[model samples]
Target chain A: MRKTFITAILLVLAAFTARAQTQEPEMADALRANGKIYVVVTVLATIFAGIIIFLVRLDRKMTKIEKNN
Target chain B: MRTWWWKILCILLVGYTVIAGFLIPVPRLDILNETIRNLYFHVPMWFTMIALFTASGIYAIKYLRSGRLQDDIYSAHYAITGIAFSVYGMLTGMEWAKFTWGEAWSNDPKQLGSAMCMLIYFAYLVLRNGLKDEEKRAKISAVYNIFAYALMIPLIFILPRMVDSLHPGNGGNPAFKQYDLDSNMRLVFYPAVTGWMLLGFWMATLRIRLHLYRFKKENSFAFENN
Candidate 1:
């Protein structure tokens, strides 16, 4: 079961890598487009994800403090 | 978050929207002519919906993992926001279709996929309302929200892409494809996406804040009585 799960994940990663490779030459073309919006979307998404991470950490600290109490 | 930042951000966003929204692209299709302006509204609405729902689905997964009520609240708002986007997309598509296709609506794969997605989330809301217990509401709603959304992305984005339709950038049309981005259009297009995404984030944060306030108030009330 574990082997199968590992293999499945590996296959998924391989497909993603392959997809990225296929998109590479187009990367030059994509870069040419000056897709400022994509950058903005990506940055905003990262910030939101960062907030989630921070919240998780804060929750953990709160839990520990409560346990001490 | 408790500062004047939101008000400032909203003012800037609305200002940008008015300026960019009217500066409409010189119509790419001769037949469509100025009809291309529909894209400003159509694309942004659809993108916002997708972003909001994605945020919701993420929350659903987290809620399931940690059994947190706050996660459930965020998930619900996200689902509703996704529905709002789907509605805007459908309506905008209908108008565009009427102009371009000479018929307002058709059983297109993309349309059907969107309808299906909206229905699933609507049912999710109904499912949540069915349960009275807080824990059960969180558990059942979280499970269904996750399941429905897992099915939603592929069925709407992926499956529809596999089939042809009147829509551009789908099936085999490169006209609307990302690769077709002309240098000129990219100037406006990319920022348009950013602006729309920012707006979507803005809405989600508003919804989340309202939820937090309600949750805090309710728990305090519960604690007081206890």
Candidate 2:
């Protein structure tokens, strides 16, 4: 089972890397050079992280309440 | 609905969307060169918002028929989460517009329609706050929710189509998919929509459970006093 799982993972990685090599150049070289693209990525990541943190906090509150009850 | 597998799927799908959306090569067009990639992130926000609001409307209908407080809780949380998604949608759209379109806030028909749709929901929240009685709050808000959602569909989807607009898929402007959604783009786009919808639902469920816990605690407190 472990060997097959590893093989499957390797196959998927190989497929992706092969596709990557054959891929056309991306259109956002200017955005990438200016570092604006990373800005967008950072903003998106931060928002997602903030939301997940909020959910985790809410979950903790509920756990406390359940314990008291 | 609250299965672990689906939540895991949401995480993986969204992770894929973020990675592929930035990295993948898209069909380079004239105006929307790289910003065309915004299709994956910005467009899915609208789809997820609509889906969540639809769920809210269903819960509202259930509340009316069942007269259950739990139903109202579900209805309210879904609407709240939907509103959050709508805000994110509008913000991302404005940011994307700043690049593609001249300004962030063009008085486009779709923009106007989006504003109206959001205002209607804001009115719903304001209406809820104004009422002090719980039973009256649930019943009236349920009716209003159904009415607001009914209006929301036409305001966002139908009305914009009738007029000349800056937004794509309406007016003279060409849609992103008109150039063919490119199987490559579809790979990220479909998963993005599904992932965001699932994430929105997950947040709504968390809020609903939190509200339920508070409601139960209050009930128990009252029982103890009695």
Candidate 3:
């Protein structure tokens, strides 16, 4: 009886693991695994930072013009 | 208007959005796949546009109440900035749709409504520019702006919900909130909207300041003679 109980518990655990694997839809696991996604993230962040810097400079120029006015 | 804190916050929030938006774990769905991350970038454009347009409408009311050209300048610049954001929203939405929806221009109810909304605002600009007299232009456009804003509410918000739309949150389609926009996404989504709205406001303020400078320059001689 104890052997049968152990076998049932092991079977249930195996089914849960198999379902977890098959149920998951495809994601960027390959890109993430190879770590190339970080490259894209870095490029985007850099471009955004550049835009922010440009805006700040423009804001300062506007302030200077306003002061002279 | 020149406060630095919110600008700084905008930078921080948007920067965080870019990083966390890409890194965060999203729901593993079949069709959406990785494009679910577009939620952080795409939806915020519309939110920012709406916020800017709302500001434009408020400034229009203020202009009518005070008969101040400065308020008119504020109104026009806010509308212009809002339109710019809308262009971005449309472009990004189309790009996302092309991949996921199998085509870009599917004549979706939401798309048609937004297109019509843009055309109405464009006509408002044309109407303003056609009047050479400054006072008349400001007053007429201010009234038109109020009407345009009133029309926008139903076209973009109400009509889309009333009809069947391929866009989520409308028709029989389940909204992102029903499934995809879980707590993990909300943390990034709300901040993304706030950051983009702040950035749009900053751009509008800069344009308003430039317009004010020109107005002062032109009127300076009159003041000096007095």
Candidate 4:
């Protein structure tokens, strides 16, 4: 599972870089130049990751309680 | 974990959405510019919110028919989840509006309608908290849930389109079918909607399980005391 996850991440990165090389569409080009878009992406990813991790931990706690019962 | 495939699918689809939404090419249009990409993010919130509330309404009907506590729990959680999505939708929409529409609150018909819909659901939450008796709470809230949802459909969907509004596909603004028909935006749009809806369901399920667990524990404790 870990291996597949790494591979998927790599594939997405590869696809991203490939697209970057092609004709870029009309976007916030200046924003992309300074790599600030990554800031937005990182913030979004972190928020979601935090939420998912919290939910998973809650699920685990519930499971332990159920087991005890 | 029992039905994990769809959960995994949700993660993948949303991950794709975040990445492609920023980097992917979008059709260039006047006024919207790069903000057009908000379509993938903003629009899906409304779709997911509607989907969740629909489920809430269905469960409300089931609770009324079966008189089952679990059904009421499910109905309540779904409404809560729907409210979460709607709140997020409104905030994001306001942000998008500030950039495009020149004001945060433009008195748009769609905006007013959605605000009223959100308040109705908020009232549902308050109603639930006011009742102390479980059975009474369940029955009354179920009736309110059904009624609120009936009003919600027209408020968000129908009433917005009937009047002049800054929102797209309403009044004189071009609809998605006209503007987005030729773009590849639909590729990500559909998946984004599905992914967000699934995520909302996932959250609701977790809440439902947590509620059920607490109820069971309380029952067992009461049994021990007896």
Candidate 5:
């Protein structure tokens, strides 16, 4: 158990070191760099619109059963 | 008899989940990059898990008030579903953490809190299993569910933010505040939360219907035999 605990600590240290060494890429900046995230956002919006259509039905069914005995 | 609107809606939701779940490329992040998009699955699983347990708690209370077996059955079904989602959530979170947090395990407040929440529900199941009488089982499980639900809030939300966190959004790490998070991600994220929640309920409802049917069948058979 002691060995396992020590290993866990060492591993966490390794991750911090890696993050410090590597220049992290910011997604917002990258999307701004490429200028495509807005379009991607629009696509995601349309997909969720489809999901709402499906869920409303299920909600109505649940309400119906709850209403009846 | 004819509720075309819901039918139409369900088709759209399924199509959206499938398309958004797979089609859109995950956005890039600094620390985790596009890999973080797995939040779409990982986060929602816990959200649904919470909703299921909250919902079960309500039914368990109702059973105590009304002496209805059906309410107890509903509680059981939802508790089971919550456990299933918790398993999926923990697995996905572990995978996400390994890649992003740089390790497979940590005692970080968020990590520990989530684990605690899973244990509370697992205990709820154990309470039910230990009882032989149906009435006793409902009473015992209902009491357990109430306490479990009460404990879950502080464990998942309040405590995690109180201390150091290896997880983003904690540990003074300047994670996404509501406004800082991408509006585009919210577009998929909010619907994803709702969609999975409804689907979780759909699973519970199917189980409830099957239970009701079996109950009725047994009663009819008893009557005929008598």
Candidate 6:
């Protein structure tokens, strides 16, 4: 009976450790590893750059209009 | 060239925000997981809106004091830009909430408060359009803008804190600062806010310039006749 109780406690401890290992929060580790994350970063940066260019052009046009007036 | 410096800074900072916001390491937590990055993007929209609205309110006060139609134009354009930012804030918030909070419209206190705040500002626009006379519209709307700004403070910032709210930094929930807004995130977050605020200001200035141009063109005959 003593041996059986010891075995049961050991099994529970092992299960707890296993659960803890698996319980680590999910993140985009796989994407980072494969470097697909950079693709997303590049896409966003390109879009932002495009917007900046548009704003700059508009500002120049406005300046020309103001000068003419 | 000197005047264009801030616009250049705005572009650089926002460009940095886009690149670093994605690549930078962030704290990992359940549920919030990757969506935690939304803090950099989503939260800045509200900050920009608040900044624009504050500018609008100040211009409104200036209009009241000086009775200058130019001040009214500045105030109106600022408010319009502010409303645009608020709409972006609301939509991004809803998208984030749908995935995290399990519903797009959870009727969260902060959400309801901001919605009410938007409606009040929308009424400001409606009030301006309802009148045809320029002076009357400016005077009445200036007063209303002051009232709207006063009400917005309590609705968006104070009321959410007074009640139980799911939003961070409100009610019982700890703000990001207390838990997960680590030093790393702050590096990108602060710049993101500055960049977005500048961008909103730039857009408002563009509208103000356009309006001013039109106003000048319309009144040029008066100046020539004089």
Error of 6 at B21 (Å): 0.3
Order of candidate numbers by lDDT, starting with the best: 6, 3, 4, 2, 5, 1
Q: In model 2, which regions exceed 4 Å deviation? A: A1-26, A30-68
Q: For residues B31-133, write the lDDT of model 1, one tens digit per residue.
A: 4545665665588788888788778888988998888898888888878767777787888888898877778878878778878888888898899889999
Question: Which pairs clash in model 3?
Answer: none
TM-score (all chains, Cα) for each model: 0.70, 0.82, 0.92, 0.86, 0.72, 0.92
TM-score of chain B, per candidate? 0.88, 0.96, 0.97, 0.97, 0.88, 0.97
Model 6's CAPRI class?
A: medium
- lDDT-superior candidate, 3 or 6: 6
lDDT of 3 at A5: 100
Candidate 4 ranges with C-alpha deviation above 4 Å = A1-26, A32-39
**Which parts of model 6 have CA positions greater than 4 angstroms off?**
A1-22
TM-score of 2: 0.82
Q: Model 3 segments beyond 4 Å from truth?
A: A1-23
Q: Give a tens-digit lDDT track for model 5, residues B1-226.
A: 1334444454456456545654455444566776656766688888899999889999989998998888998998998988888889889988888878888787778889989998988988888899999889988888888999999999987888788897767667566544335766666667777767766776676567657656667777999999
Per-residue lDDT for B95-150 in model 6, tens only?
99998889999999999999999999999999999999999999999999999999
Model 4's DockQ score: 0.19
What is the C-alpha lDDT profile of model 4 across B1-226, one tens digit per residue?
A: 4456887888888878887778766776667879988888898999999999999999999999999898998999999999999999999999999999999999999999999999999999999999999999999999999999999989987998888999998887778768664457887888888988888898888788789778888988999999
Error of 6 at B98 (Å): 0.4
All models, RMSD in angstroms: 15.5, 11.3, 3.5, 12.0, 11.4, 4.2
DockQ by candidate, in order? 0.02, 0.14, 0.58, 0.19, 0.15, 0.54
Model 1, runs deviating above 4 Å? A1-69, B1-14, B24-27, B178-180
**Best of the candidates, DockQ:** 3
lDDT of each: 0.69, 0.85, 0.93, 0.87, 0.75, 0.94
**Residues B1-226 of candidate 3: C-alpha lDDT, one tens digit per residue:** 3688999999999999999999888888878899999999999999998999999999999999999999999999999999999899999999999988999999999999999999999998899889999999999999999999999999898999998998988878888999889999999999998998989998989999999999988899789999
